[model samples]
Each structure stands twice: as C-alpha cells, then as structure tokens.
Target: MIAVVTVLLAFPLGYLLRSHLAANVAYAIAYLWAFTFQTLYLTLSMLGGDDSAFSKNEFPISYGLVAAGIFGIGFGLVALGHRVGSRRTTRQAVS
Candidate 1:
C-alpha cells in the first residue's frame, strides 16, 4: 500500500524535476539514502519489539519491495532527464 504510493508519487516528481541534472542526481541520491535509513529503522523496530510468526517472515520482503520502488524512481528520473535534454537540444537546433 504505502510502497505503491511512494513509487507512483516519486516517479512523476522525479520526471518533472529532471531538467536540472545536478539537482535531479542529488535528489535521487538523497532518496536512496533516506530509504536506506528507513530500512534500518524498520529492521531495528522489528528486532527490538516484535512478536508472532508473521512479523519475522514479512519484514524483509516488504523492505526489499520498497527499495525496488526507490530504484525505479531513480531510473525513471534519469530517463526523463535524458528525454527532456534531448528534446530541448533539438528545439534549439531548429530555431
């Protein structure tokens, strides 16, 4: 649920901000760092205070999926940046 929303939101935002290559790269790095921190936090939480059979089983999978989502966002942003930059170059050449 949350994972899906994060991916969907991140993709378009990344795309829209893709024109600024440095900024986009920084943003993607920041996102990756943040997600890593989130994984650590989740792991700590699960280890410190957890119960039942399901908690141990589900945590790793959920975390991996979220990481995948973040990667997808980063890739989408890079691709969008390339597309936007190329288009701008083409238009400038024509003019």
Candidate 2:
C-alpha cells in the first residue's frame, strides 16, 4: 500500500526530470529516492512498534513483490518519459 505510493510518485518525478537528465538516470534517481523513503518508512514503523504492516507468513513474499513492483514502475516511467520527450522532438523535427 505505502510502497505503491512511492512507485506512483516516481512516475511524475521521472517525467519532470526527463528534460534535464537521461530517462534512465531520471528513473533510477526516482527509484532510489523512493527506496530510501521506503527503508525509512519501514525502519520507523518497526521502531515505532507497529508490526501490523508485516504479515507472519507472507512477509517475505510481500516484500519481494513490492521491490519488484518498484523496479518495474521505474522502468515504465523511463519509457513514458522517453515517449513524451520523443514526441516533442519529433514535432520539432517535422516543423
């Protein structure tokens, strides 16, 4: 749930950063940022004594899914940034 938000946040950041950096780099930075946030989130949650976020039997699976999802989201955002950036370039070339 919270992890999903981080992934979603990466999309816009990747899009916005595309103009200043390569798509891959932008996505990587966004993903790393999100990952850092997630780490902090988990650490805080544990320290704060909230164990509800972790399921007894499903913890490992859930964590893996979230990590993979974040990676995929980063790649997707880079593709999206490239698509959008290419459109402008294509239009300018035609003009």
Candidate 3:
C-alpha cells in the first residue's frame, strides 16, 4: 500500500524534473530516504515497542533525525547532480 503510493508519487515527480538532473537526483534521494525511514518505522512499530515511555521519546527523536538526514542527503545529491550537469552542459555547448 505504502510502496504503491511512494512509487506513484516518485515516478512522475522524477520524470517531470528530469530536465534538471539536480531535480531528478533530489527527487530520487528524497524518495529513497523516505522509503528507508518508513520501512524502519513500520518494522520497529510492529515489534511492539510503543508501550514504553522510552520508546515514545526515542522514536520521535529518531524519526526527526532520520528526516533531517534524508533532507540533507537529498540536497547533497541535488547539488552534486547540478554541478555535474552544469559541467556537461558547458562542455557540450563549447563543442
């Protein structure tokens, strides 16, 4: 169910932003990160750790960190892709 939604959302977004390699890479990274976090969250939640106070506090903090990391990775990928694409475009334009 979640996987279906993720794919549906990710594909067109990736395609529409494809013209800018940076945007494509950003979308991919963000989707991948979100997928990873969701998988981890579901797995942990299914294991039944929610009954504890420690679990409640830890989970939210962990989730926040995961989200931040995902955003950072996505931005990093976008920046790298943008640099590479710019170089390629410049080279082609020169030639």
- Residue 70 Cα positional deviation in candidate 1, in Å, after optimal superposition: 3.2
Better of 1 and 2 by lDDT: 2
Sort by TM-score, top down from the best: 2, 1, 3
lDDT: worst 10-residue window of model 3: 1-10
**Per-model TM values vs. the true structure:** 0.53, 0.63, 0.49
lDDT, candidate 2, 1-95, per-residue tens: 43565456545654555453565665576667766787678668866777766643444567768787768766776577667766777898999
Candidate No. with top TM-score: 2
RMSD of each: 4.8, 3.7, 7.0
Better structure of 1 and 3 per lDDT: 1
Model 1 lDDT vs. the true structure? 0.60
Q: Which residue runs of candidate 2 sit more than 4 Å off their true CA positions?
A: 1-21, 55-59
What lDDT tens digits, residue by residue, belong to model 1 across residues 1-95?
A: 33443455444554455355654565566666677776666667778875431276555565577567767766675567557766767788999
Evaluated with lDDT, which candidate comes out highest? 2
Clashing residue pairs in candidate 1, if any?
none
The 0-to-1 C-alpha lDDT of every candidate, in the order given, reads 0.60, 0.64, 0.56
